[model samples]
Target: MGTVIVVGAGIGGVTAAVALQRCGWGVTVLERSVTLGEVGAGISVWPSAVAVLTELGVKGIDQAAALSGPTALRKPSGRWVVGAADLGVELPVMIHRAQLHGLITAEFGPGVTVRTGYLVKTVTQDDSGVLINDELRADLVIAADGLRSVIRSALHPQYAGPRYSGYTAYRGIADVRADDGGETWGQAQRFGVTQLIDGRAYWYATANQPAGQGGDLAAVIRRYGGWHDPIPAILAATDTALQNDIYDLTLPLVPFATGRIALLGDAAHAMTPNLGRGACTAIEDAGALARHLQSAPDPLTALTRYDAERRPIATKLVKRSRQIGQLGQLDNPLAVGVRDVLMSVGASAARGAAALRKMKQSRRDHSSAGS
Candidate 1:
């Protein structure tokens, strides 16, 4: 079997290692941390990602994941903006991020070996093989090091780092049942809520605060305590909340691969989480790379195909995500009013489409009954 090296032990990295291992490659995953862990929050996997993970032998995610859909957009004063159906998307499967990470890690099986505490300070690709930190060489190198990836910087030094979108997010799991809780968009801020598997609630909010500020729960409570139903309760019920500044890569990489090394996951395209497609796209990259590796003549050819197939799609997604983020955080009153009006009109159109669909189904049922 050929040898492959995967950098970082995140969801994308581990998924890639397992996929390659199943393809009969001896894979080594190098992780900077001594232990495997994920942040305490929820992740929603769209239908596309759920299918890919299931095909790769991971199981029971559907049972564990609560469905996330039928959400309503509301104003901070509790007026309706639109329902989620207006956007025309399939329901995403929601599970804890750590649970998904563990499932991906478990699929490593015996074909892959994981080495911890091995930080990849440098990556260089030679004609024979790619080298990591100048100590180890493999036929291929997959960089899944995350948003501030050193490998990415090495590949394109001209690329500037992540751009802060002038927003900070607070995430936490609250031991409360909030069924009608969805997203609320106000002036320069937004709040969202969804249910977890065990009847708990997963809530998140983005604000116009400076990056890396407001790392306390009281601050969150002060800002949103009086907004709407369940928001105050969720915050008050939370034991603690974790905060992070939202940053995304604005500049698109022309090509996602160079020589023997290829980028994956956030390292490749770190888009905003506005569409909830960031992780789904990363998982897609794993499946795509694995497919090409099995079909191509060699590792280099496979990397080239992976780059060609994934780059354009990811770049387009990055642009869409940015647009959504900008629209969601609009502070101007007139702009927000226009957006709400359009959303209201779109919701009407969506409802009309749904009624048409139901009518067609009813006709089919009646015809079958008459037969």
Candidate 2:
């Protein structure tokens, strides 16, 4: 077996390297930054990815994170629209992005090497192997870089870049304790919070702000500062928050693998965070890729199998995530009214109970299929 070169050391890259190394493949991770770290605030992992993590022997996530509470969907006027009590699954578990990164990076020991500050220039692949910068050769190359993947561009030069979803997001983590999860829906704006295991809260607000405009936390406070209980307090206690113009790629969700070189995570299918599947989906991608590679006969065949199995599922998830974001960002009066009505009607205790049942069934189906 030859060495596998994985570009970028983000969650997806690290997970891939770890999984491949466990399968007896030599792995090297090249990261552009000087160190391995996460800039984002928080991430939610769903049960699908959690199962994958358990299979991979990645531990401590349960202790470092907190399960999200029932989500309270409210109207712009602060009226209760829907409570996530009906939604299926454990409302995604929230963990600081840095904490998750640290956990994944700790798993790379003898067979895996991580190199930082190595900005990849180009990639060329032949029948025998792939070469990075025309110098290093490997039996396989994994482009887990990110949405702005340089390797992706080299592979698909004619493909379009990531498209902005016409919205901006503001996120902050505060050191305040809260009992229940919170969410407020306003015309063209939404705010929510999840309490971390440390008792601190990770809150986020999204609005129809201008692209590239830095989020003004003070302005957000002034606009939505008067909403409901706990929000005012959460914002008041927030020492700092990061803001960014939310964007999603318009590319068709397709298999990103080309021969022995492959793409994973955001590089493969970057979607909105509305459904909270961003990190979870990436983790699932790592798991699926690893599983295929371990069982396949050769590197090339394994990469192909990974694409065939993952492309359809990931594409559907991408579409669902975008739709959810669009629904939350609706500002029209009539549309907002309809959305609120649907939420209220759909958020009953019975509905929630039914959702949990369905979720359990779905998990079983997935497990059976994988087996």
Candidate 3:
């Protein structure tokens, strides 16, 4: 079996380690942080991500995940722009980022060894193998190092750093009693609320701002306080919030692979959170890397195949995410009103279609009974 080293201990890096080890490869995960953890906020593991975790036998997600009922998109005044029926998500589960990260890492066990505080200054690769920090040598290196990846910088020196989404976000947990959660849109800003498995509520807000400008949760709440019922209550109940300026790898990577190394996760495609697909895509990348490696005869070819397969879709997602962010942060009053109107019209049309389909089905059932 070949040996592979993965840099970073993020959800993507840990996931890749497990996937590769399962495919008969010796795996080592190198994390810069002494301890492994994620933000206290929540992330939604969509059905696609759920499938990936199930395939890899990752536990705790099913037990710890909070299954959501109906969600909606609404105006600040509580007018529903679109309901759950319009944007049909069959099974969406929300879990704390730190919790999910812990569960995924636990699945690795002794099969994969994780070395903390081992940050690689540079990675050099020849035709046969790559050397990390000039000490460790492996048949392949997986750079899941995240948005500020040293590996990514070494490879693409000409590329600028990540592009900001022109918005700042705050994530926190609140004890508010909210079962059905949704997003409320204010001009140039948005607030999302969802239930967590621990009987708490997870809410996040985004507002138009220049890069790197952030404030306390109270300040953020001040901007969105008068929106609706649950918004003020949820913020008031929250104690602390994680504030940061959102950024994405809007500039696409040329290729996901070079020689014996492959970039995974945010290192490859750091997308905006509007789509809520960043972590989900990384999980998908890990699975795809393992699948491609199993089929290919050599690690280089496998890495290349992984690149060809994953890069296109992830790049498209990056673009899509940014577009969604732009739409959500539109400040123009005319534009905001127009967007809300269009969304309402669309939702109404979907409901009418569903009703018509139900009526037709009932008629068909009656005719069959008569027959």
lDDT tens per residue, model 3, 1-371: 68899999888998898898888888988989888777658998988988998899898788999887579998888888899988755757999888999888788856688899887998998988899989999999999999988998999898885988889998989987677688988899999999988888999899998886778887877888898888888988999988888999857565789888899999999988988889999999999999999999887888889998999999899998899899999999999999889888888888898899999999999999999
Which window of ten consecutive residues has the lowest lDDT sum in model 2?
82-91
lDDT of each: 0.86, 0.83, 0.88
Segments of candidate 3 deviating more than 4 angstroms = 357-371
The per-residue C-alpha lDDT of model 2 at residue 150 equals: 94
lDDT of 1 by residue, 101-203 (tens): 9888878788898899888898888798888888999988899999998899998898886889888888889999868857999888899999988789999
> Candidate 1 — number of clashing residue pairs?
0
Ranking by lDDT: 3, 1, 2
Better of 1 and 2 by lDDT: 1
Candidate 2 structure quality by residue, lDDT tens digits, 1-371: 67899998888888888888888889989999999788878888888887887788888989988898777777646677765555544666889989988888788879998889999999998899999987878889999988888988888888895888878888998889867687788889999888888999899999986788776779779878888878888889898878888877675854678988999988888888888887787888888888888788887788899898888887888888888889988979799889888777767755867878899999999999999
How much does candidate 2 score in TM-score? 0.92
Per-residue error at 91 for model 3, in Å?
A: 4.1
lDDT computed for candidate 3: 0.88
Judged by lDDT, which candidate is best? 3
As a whole number from 0 to 100, the lDDT of residue 274 in candidate 3 is: 87
